[model samples]
Target: MFTRIQAQVLGALGVVVVLGALTLFLVPASEPAPAPVAQPAPEVVDVPEEVPFVTHQVVGTSREGRTIEVYTYGTGTRDILLVGGIHGGYEWNSVLLAYEMMDYFEAHPTAIPADVTVHIVPVLNPDGLAQVVSGEGRFTPDAVRTDVPLGTGRFNAAGVDLNRNFGCKWQPESSWRGTRVSAGTAAFSEPEAAALREYVLAHMPESVVFWHSKAGAVFASECHEGVLPETKTLMQTYADAAGYKPILTFDAYPVTGDAEGWLASIGIPAITVEFHTHESMDWAENLAGVTALLARP
Candidate 1:
């Protein structure tokens, strides 16, 4: 019986030793070394480099050093100045409208009348435009809207009513029935106004078309002196094509130091086209009006 017990104990010890060896060898010493994965080469994305264009940017830096871009097209003696976005961010439709025109000319390239040069100051107030661009990307004609920043942005970056900052029958103070107005420190005090004035003086464009919104009719500029003869003809020409009646005078309110009036004083014909529709871009209609306006008499 004693011999049998010793023999059983020896057998158990041998089984335990074999099991311990199996566990040590079969189990992972550390984590099983992961199989090396051959990673595919990373894809190289193609990004186009900056390509310069013929369109020159004449910097009209605002008081805040915001750059206002002016683009000129065509190589002609007869120049047509197109000014838009005068109301800044609130009336982004005007800015879009102007940009649309620029796009048109860019695509067509030959749309610009050879004898007539076209100049576009697409965004007159960079600060205002920056506000609009940061919002939704679209501004429709049906939405005769503006994102007024604290209602203080109705004017330029410097709070000068650009239209009211011109030298045309300028006033010390102008009234805006909408509860916001600015006339600047003096006539053309704001850099925006000065830049435009300088460009106008330098270019001496034969006519200027200023775009606005919600009025839906075209108006010719007139001060105390009265409308110029060419102003009436210019308005008629555009209206005849656009199928809208000509509003010889704005008469909505008395405006002083108006840009149109200033242009008129310098013997340049200027017409203000105020779109009637909002929330919808009437660019098609207005383009016709402009095309007709640009058509040779």
Candidate 2:
């Protein structure tokens, strides 16, 4: 039924189709698709700083069972220990000053000299810190007592002025508004004082800084024995930075059993940094002083 032209066209189309199918199915497998490239593994991101090597936390449980922690920093051959708020409620600003130092060390890990280790005990009296924080996170030595239903919170839960309670030179229990208060039972009877001693013994730091309030001077680490020659150098370092005159002797009172004196007795160059009437004015100067101390050549 078909003409010669039609038959030839149909035969040619069939051959073309068969050839195309054979070429695709039998193409000798050109190199398999290049193996999918592997992207480099993603890089690790930001990491929080690690807690510095802690010599130890000399633990002193407060009358309220709260922890009074002493953190030892750095491990240089030349070491320094900074203690804050041994006076408890009487000197709340002292504790805050210590905390500021702690924050600085945490944020600026490299601020401390590589050759020296700094020990920071932020709060000497957790009991006092608790009362201070409950009201204002910051406090001062001259903070006037406003009418409060609970009365003055100037002592521990056990009603002992821990500073006065140390046995450096024990005195008869005096009254601060009818609160009998020179000192309690015996030397180092107060847990906070005891904890400080424990830390000082354990670290045996080359120098020490004990923060106090209202005194507004850097007392050379001194005692009945004498002012340390190294303490004179250390005081000058901090005093030069603060721009305030350093009072070498704190002959303000018949003070005894104070932590600084205790430290000095053992020949550790200890300084007590007393702020102006207000605690807030103390920190920036102290920061400058501390940096200068750390940066000393």
Task: Compare the candidates by TM-score and give the number of the best one.
Answer: 1
TM-score of 1: 0.74
lDDT (Cα) of model 1: 0.76
User: Model 1 over residues 61-150: C-alpha lDDT tens digits?
Assistant: 877777777877776778888988777765567788888888887777677676767789987776665554554333444333345443
lDDT of 2 by residue, 206-285 (tens): 77887776667888856667888888988999988986569788664556666677777777888877788633637678
How big is the positional error of residue 51 in model 2, measured in Å on the Cα after superposition? 9.4
Model 2: lDDT of residue 40:
90
- RMSD of every candidate to native, in Å, equals 21.6, 14.3
Model 1 bad stretches (over 4 Å):
1-54, 135-152, 178-180
Clashing pairs for predicted structure model 2, backbone only: 74-117, 174-182
